[model samples]
Target: MENFFDQYRDEVQPALKSKLEEFILFGYDSVTEEELWQYLCKKKWKREREAKLLYQIVNDILSVKIGEYMNFATVEAFKSPDWFGNQGKDELSKLL
Candidate 1:
C-alpha cells in the first residue's frame, strides 16, 4: 500500500511543489514536500487512493490548508520517539 502513490508522484510533483510553496509562504517554514506528500498519503487520501483520479489528487494537494497540514505534522511529531529519547532525564525534566 505504501508504494500505491509512488507511480503518480512524478505526475503530481508540480502540484506538490506549488502546495509546498504556499505552506512556506504562510510561515510554515519547516514543512517539506515529502512531508506534505506523506500527509496526503497517510491521512487525506489514505482510504481512497485507488478510487481517486489524478486530477482529484492534485486538487486535494492544492486545496489543503495550512491548519490541516500543520495539525497533521504536529500529530506526526508527537508520534516520533526521538523527541524524549534524545534528551537526558534532566533535560526532559527541564522541558516538563
Candidate 2:
C-alpha cells in the first residue's frame, strides 16, 4: 500500500507543479511588480511543489485530487501567524 501510494505521488507531482507555476505566473502578470515578487517569494514555488505533492499523496491514499484537498493546506500556510504567505487561490478561483 505504501509503495503504491509513493508511485501515485510521483505521477502526480509534475502535473501539480506545472499547474502551480501557471498559477504563479498568471498572478505575476496581473499584479504589480512588488506584490508579484512578494507572492512568488512567499509561496516559494519549489517548496510548495514538494509540499503539495506530499499533501496529494497522503490524500490520494483515499482517492482525493489536488483541487479536492488544497484548500486547507493553503489556508493553513497562509494563516501561519508566524510569517506571511499567499495561498495563490486567486487564479484557482478564476478558473472555477
Give the C-alpha miss distance for residue 80 in model 1, angstroms.
Answer: 1.2
What's the lDDT for all of these models?
A: 0.84, 0.42
Mark the regions of model 2 whose C-alpha exceeds 4 Å error after superposition.
Answer: 1-6, 28-74, 77-96
Weakest 10 consecutive residues, lDDT, candidate 1? 81-90
Say which candidate scores most in TM-score.
1
Candidate 2, 1-96: lDDT as tens digits:
122233454555554455445545645233232332233334333244343455554343334233333453466558777452255566556678
Candidate 2 root-mean-square deviation in Å: 14.2
**Residue pairs that clash (backbone atoms under 3 angstroms), model 1:** none
Model 2 is weakest, by summed lDDT over 10 consecutive residues, at 28-37
C-alpha RMSD for every candidate? 2.7, 14.2
Residue 39, model 2: lDDT of: 36
